[model samples]
Target chain A: MKKILILVVVALLSATGYGYYLFQKPSKDIATTKPYLSTIAPQLIAKFGSGQTSSSSELLSKVIQVSGKVTDIEKGKESIIIVLNEGIKCEIILDKNPPFVKGDYLTVKGIFSGFDDMFNEISLTKCYIVL
Target chain B: MKNKLLIMLITITVFGAFAQNKKVTRTGSVQFLSKTPIENIAAQNNQVASILLVNEKQIAFNVLMKSFKFEKALMEEHFNEKYVHSNKFPAAKFKGSIPPSVALDKAHNYEGVEINGQMLFHGVKKPLIIIANIEVKEDLSISFSSSFNLKLEDYDIKVPSLVKDKISEQIKISVATNYK
Candidate 1:
């Protein structure tokens, strides 16, 4: 009876360990290499907004480069907005202020993340000031 | 000279009459929801694009999709990337007519009328019917409120199985606008 109880306890512990492993595992498949420049475009990035907001996790931390003509400039309390065509805009929040104006052609590289409801904004890890 | 003067007067009167009755401003709001019952979503491009009102028989509303906003950073990210996919399609529009029995007066509150129309979201067009309480208050403000369902699958949105129970099949939407 003692040996049987010990075996049962061990089996229960192993089952609990396996359950925790599945729960804690990361769902995302992170890419070691940086995303190709050609793959990043205003049109391509805009396609990400077509589905449910919860799916953004799949694209988080992925490097992306987007190019578009600046339409408007919004200076906010914590960030700046660079608007592209067709009401598509990107908000860049900085540790320090970055100088930019509306209508300046821009190419930004950052990690794609979601922001204020229904917004797919990029957290700019690095911004390339391309005229 | 007299005939020319008469024609010019007629033209001016006609233009003025049309302008007085024209429905100029159109605006709306789309609320975002999660399973947690949080009601804090907004849009940046919150301008009403176009409107048409003819004898209370026809009405239309158009909204730019880029305007929705949220409070939390993570929620907002999921909204655009996972839910709205605003990058591919940029606009949500409603075109419909009001019930004939409802009268729109420049003064006095109008009864809440049922608006039947087609709602275009994520490039897919679907039939949408909403009840809106619209009033042309003091010849200035146009107040409206109508909540409707937004189906995810209608626009090809695939909700992951893990969180499927958290989201509703039809999202409730409310809209309000004031003329410029």
Candidate 2:
């Protein structure tokens, strides 16, 4: 009976450890994420033109892949911003610079946050350069 | 009628040339920090859009709430879902004019000014007065920096009793931008 009780306790401890591991798992990589920029940009522009603020509900908070020419690069104190196609912008929250430079075609995967009403721009966050 | 058309053309061309003096940047940055006894929380947003109307001494900035990135994923989620409710209030904006006391000519190069503006954030509009440094580069680029502090409660951000110690009552916000 004592041996059986010890085995049960060990099993319960392992189960809890596994649960914690799953709970603290990092987010999935952007390469595995879906929905490319070609589809998202037009939708965002359409919504902006129509004066609709709540149109892209399906894309919000979801990791998406976006590709475009780097029109401008903005260096921040802590991060970098890559503006694409004039209106679509991604915020890369990292100390290091991305591999590409301005005018280079690149693709990145990031979380689509929402639109900027004052600037009429689509905003994404926590971006990772995929290409 | 022909002379009137010619005069209108010249006027449009002159206005277009004058408007070219405006400097704009879509990738400005704004960072905020919250300090408390238990922890310090900081988030930075790089997708800040700023326009400097050099001719008018007016500046405007727009930043999306969802663009702010936090170090911890869980904390970021909590900020968007619980505190900011980013889906409801999408963006923050400021429209201000540089004080006339500061000069922006080539002779001055740099000036310190108090920008009096209206800030719109979290579905509320408040009057904001921020002191900032502006440098006009030889290349015609403008560099700006400002820091200000504000209470979270002023924007209707509520802190739960469970993690009250982890969050600060007043947060420090900094804005830095380079426009061309």
Q: Which residue pairs collide in model 2, if any?
A: none
* Tens-digit per-residue lDDT, A61-103, candidate 1: 4556677777665543334555555233454645466565666
> Each candidate: what lDDT?
0.56, 0.77
Shift of residue B33 alpha carbon in model 1, Å: 3.5
Residues B1-180, model 1: lDDT tens digits: 999999999999998776655554422334544433533334333333445454555666655444454444455456666876765554577788877766555554665577888988888898888887777678644556566667788877777887777666666576665432
The segments of candidate 1 whose C-alpha lies over 4 angstroms from its true place after superposition are A1-131, B1-5, B26-28, B35-45
The ten-residue window of minimal lDDT in model 2 chain B covers B103-112
Error of 1 at A120 (Å): 24
Residue lDDT tens for model 2, B67-131: 78776667777888899887778788999989776555453555457899998878888999998
Return the TM-score for candidate 1, rounded to 2 decimals.
Answer: 0.53
If you score just chain A, what TM-score does every candidate get?
Answer: 0.49, 0.67
Q: How well does candidate 2 score on lDDT at residue B72?
A: 64
Give the clash count for model 1. 27
